[model samples]
Target chain A: MLNNSITAAMADIATAVKRYSLVGMLGWQDVRQRYRRSAVGPFWLTISMGVMIGTIGLVFGQIFNSPMKEFLPFLAAGMILWSFISTCVLEGCSSLIAAESIIKQLPIPLFVHILRTIWRNTLILAHNIVIFPLVLLAVQKPLGLEALWSIPGFALLVLNLAWISLILSLLCARYRDLPQIIASVLQIAFYLTPIMWLPSLLPGRAGTYLLDLNPIYHLLQIVRAPLLGQDVSTVSWCVAGGMALFGWCIAIIIYGLYKRRIAYWL
Target chain B: MACIEFNNACVDFPIYNASARSLKKRLIQVATGGKISSNEQGRVIVRALEDLTFSLNDGDRVGLLGHNGAGKSTLLRLLSGVYAPSAGTASISGEVASLIDISLGIDPEASGRENIFMRGILLGMTKSDIAEKLEEIIEFSELGDFIDMPVRTYSSGMHLRLAFAVSTTIRPEILIMDEWLSVGDEGFKHKAEARMNELVEATSILVIASHSRDLVLHTCNRVIWLEHGKIKMDSDPETVTRAYFGH
Candidate 1:
């Protein structure tokens, strides 16, 4: 029975992945629908992100007593990646819930909804990340071969988010208050993950271990470190990779057990 | 060769109330070993469908007749592969289009043309297929220039016309519908009915749930009467409809 359930869940995931055209179009529609009537459209998101980064960078730099020249790019990269991760986690909770109408009316795989959510957020992230290069230029950060590491780092990040979305979407569908709980958790995670402050500010060995223990910090390091022209630490890569594998294992198990229950939950 | 088979299939819905859905309450219940548990905090299971054993082969038009709380819609969902059976099994073979809600994926902010694509994708049509049927769908909807405008601006009748057009445009092996789909004025209803007949005739299998006896007699050859989540009668539409209505 367990093997059969796992096989069925795998088949569902395969079918959802095979229907990429449908998933991609739906994701594009999701992004388009949100900014339909606005004059500035989704660029409004880009503009707002830019303004937020600027304000936060100056204020936090002064507060941390760090140089704006070094700090702005670091803050910008971390903030941009954090936005992507946070939105993926937050909206991931509603990936299936938001698509309840479509789910009920159609016979598509549940993972299709998760893919659509991730893709939609990825599109929005694309819009927000346009500010990154300009910030790098503003901060006089040079482009280097090390910066290319961010490409693989981002690919891994997307893979991790996909599994995370799958698990959260199902769990949140089952438990209605989960989305709110996730939101509050992310609020705490924002401070705990070291997005605003340098890890160096922490006094000693315990601070280093504490940062190491944070999966989000490791996830952030893999992408942000490279984008800010720093070495991509092997420990960060190993932790992020391990998290991806561990997350997928949990996601697949939960999905296998609860795959059929989602429609009922909805 | 579309077919659907259910072997003693059952569906139980765990209706989670607020307290049951909350992690804190559930944890407390688990930790306290039901000592502090209230009935409301426990999971309430509703057996929506029970021991539903049936098979539908090609060229069959089956109508489901049941009271409000009976499992007509649940059966349709089961056939459409929306809800897997909690016990037993169901095997469905087909490209299925479940018209439970024709306007399900319609976006109010999008134009009728864009909604056609959106709704078409949701209906299991590929982008290229929708592109090919674009002219046919728009022509069938009879919205003319309104097709270019946001669906939010459409009158209720116009919106129904667009939804009906996009939904029926698909050619599925098995078509599952709930209730009778009605649209617009008398003229439009006749047109929609004619189009629906054409679509249904082309499909290999049709499962419809409805309270309308005349509709069942007109559209279906076989009928299943459900009472309290069990099949009470399965026979010719004439016999079941007559018995169902006590006429």
Candidate 2:
């Protein structure tokens, strides 16, 4: 039975990966449905995110006693990545639950729902990230080779979020209160991960260690530091990469055990 | 060729109520190792299907007749590959189209045209396939210009027409339906029935679960009567339906 389940789980994942076109189209429809009937469409999300970053950058820059030139770009990159990360966690919790009708009715792979969630959030992240380049230009940040580092950094971030979303989505589907717990945890995570604040402002070694202890902080640094024209730390890459490997190990094991039960759970 | 084989297949549903579905309670149960004695209060297990053994070869039109909660729908779902049996095994080969719930993925806020694609995808059709059948599906729905409008604006009958049109657009080797489909006005029902008959004739195997004895007798060659997850009777439609209705 154990061997059978493991094979079944792998087969399901393989099938879901093979049907990328279906996943992509469904993801596109999800974004389109949310923005239907709007004149500006998904650009409206970009506009609101831009406004939030601008206002928060100004007010928080003054409070932190930091220069607007540095603060604005940092805030923009951090907020955009944070929105992507947090939304993946918050919305990922309901990924399987929200697709209950399709899950119960269709014979498609369970991994399809996970991919659909990740892809949908990725599209919305694409819309929200438009503000990053504009913010960088506004701050007069120079284009450098280091900015290209963010390409790999962002890809790694997506890979990690995919596993995280799959794990959380399954857990949340089985346990009804998991979404609420995830939401509350993300609320604390936003403050803890230093999106609105600077890690450099922390007084000493303990503060530095605190940032190191946070996996979210590591994920943020890999992408945010490079996009802000700062040096991407080797340590952040190591931590984030390690977490991805470890997270997938746990996610797949849990999936192998619980995937067949998901339909019944729903 | 299409075939479905179930060898003593069983499905047990773990009924997780509010307390059972809570992580905190489960965590506490683990931490205390059940010493607190609240672990068993809400864990209810329902055996939806038990030791169900059956097989179907190509060109078999099997009908399932049973009272409510007799595992007919669960059995259909098992054959459709939606639910993996908890025990024993099920082997099914062939493309399957399940009209268990015609509106399974219909979005009320989406336009009928968009819904055709959405429902088509959910029903296992590719985008280009849906595109190829788009005109036919819309024309069959008979909603005309209303196809461009949101489905929420449609009346229930119109909604059923749209769902039925998209659902029947695909031809599968194995077709499974939970109940008899009867929709739309008298004129439209005739049209829908004709379409259903054409699709059913094209499939290699058909498994329909219904309570209608007359309907099953008319359409199916074989019948299986279920009682509380076990096969109560299995025979030809005439014998099974007669036995089912006490004729």
Candidate 3:
């Protein structure tokens, strides 16, 4: 009986999903909803990143004796990757809670909420991509066919984010304070990560370990490394791949155990 | 083609103390050798539906009558595949359209035209399907100039008119409705009711829950009276309604 019901539910979800080009529209809606009624729309994200990069590059480059041209592109890449990582973790915290209305009322697939979160953040990430071109052109940075690798790099980032969003959603639904803790932890991670500071600049063993322990740093490495036309390390792929597997495995377990109770939880 | 069967369905929910949003509080209580009394925990296990079993064939106009929390909504949720039963199985065939919490998927900040896509997506309609029905939904809603306005700016009537129009546009094999609440003004009510009546005619199977005896008598040929998460009486509408009213 349970098997039959599970199969039926799966079929229903498939049908619901097939009816709409959910990926296409959901991504658009997520972007539009966030920037609604705003003058610049998503360009605001690009503009702000641009301003931060310019200020930090000019002021800090002079202080650190690093060339402003080299520092500007680095800063732009850092800011964009930081935004992507922060958005994935922060939004993962409320992926379920934010959709409480739909969750409580409709019988749609729970995964749709996670998809919505990833798609929403992906939109911002796309906008942030605009800065790379501007920075590259301004700095006269090396750009070639290797830069196109960012497309696949970002695809991996999004896939990994999907796993993270799903697992975090299940956890936050069970634990209310998780979202706040996650948000606070992400704030700390931003500093721990080599966002404003270069990794080589970190003094010693302790700092290197801290950088190594932080997953967001690796995520940024995969993205920024490819965008900078550098070869991505195997370490980045291994860490991201491991986290994705671990997250998705745990999510499936939790989903299987509590799939029946999720509705009542809402 | 629309057939629905529920067999000894049960839904069991855990009773977690969500009031204090911290594990430390719960852990402290646990370490202190059960600070929270067992009686307090009984308030947590909610059996929304228990051992429910039923089947409906095509063209079954079944009205479900129950007081709030009597498993009426749970039954509808189960039938609609929203909430799976904790035990037993529900075998359903054909397309199901549930009208539970009408206007649920509409975004308040989006225009009526945008909401058409939002609500339609939630209701399992493709983008092309929403586009196809856009004109008919707009016409039936009669919100002429206001269709382009944000839903937040719409009156309660306008909200219902558009929601009902969009929801009823697709004729599902099974149409399930929770108690239809009032959405708009008097004239709007007439138009909405007419649309609902047409929807009823178009659907092959209809399930509704309401407290109103008149509504049950008028719209349903069969009725099930539920009490305390159990079926109190199940029979023809006139018979059950009469028994319920004690007339």
lDDT per residue as tens, model 1, B68-101: 9898888888899888899999999988889998
Candidate number with the higher TM-score (1 or 3): 1
| Lowest summed lDDT window (length 10), candidate 3 chain A | A11-20
In the range B175-204, model 2's lDDT, one tens digit per residue, is: 999877889999999999999999999999
Candidate 3 per-residue lDDT, tens place, B3-69, comes to 9988998877655676643556656767877656467633457787778788898778999988778
Give the runs in model 1 whose Cα sits over 4 Å from its true position. Answer: B36-41
Score each candidate by Cα lDDT: 0.89, 0.88, 0.78
Instruction: List runs of model 2 lying over 4 Å from the truth.
Output: B35-42
Q: Candidate 3, residues A1-266: lDDT per residue as tens digits?
A: 45554564455335534543664566688788778899999999888888888888888878777775667777788888888877887787788778887776666777777776777787788887798888899888877788777777777787788767766877777777788888888888888887777676667986768767778877778778777777888888888778777765565555556666667666
User: What DockQ does every candidate get?
Assistant: 0.71, 0.65, 0.53
Model 2: share of real contacts kept: 0.69
Q: Could you tell me how far off, in angstroms, the CA of residue A41 lies in candidate 1 after the best superposition?
A: 1.6
Q: What is candidate 1's lDDT per residue for A21-139, written digit by digit as tens?
A: 88898899888888988888888988988999999998889999998778888888888889889999899899899888777667898899899888888899888989988997898
Q: What overall lDDT, based on C-alpha atoms, would model 2 receive against the true structure?
A: 0.88
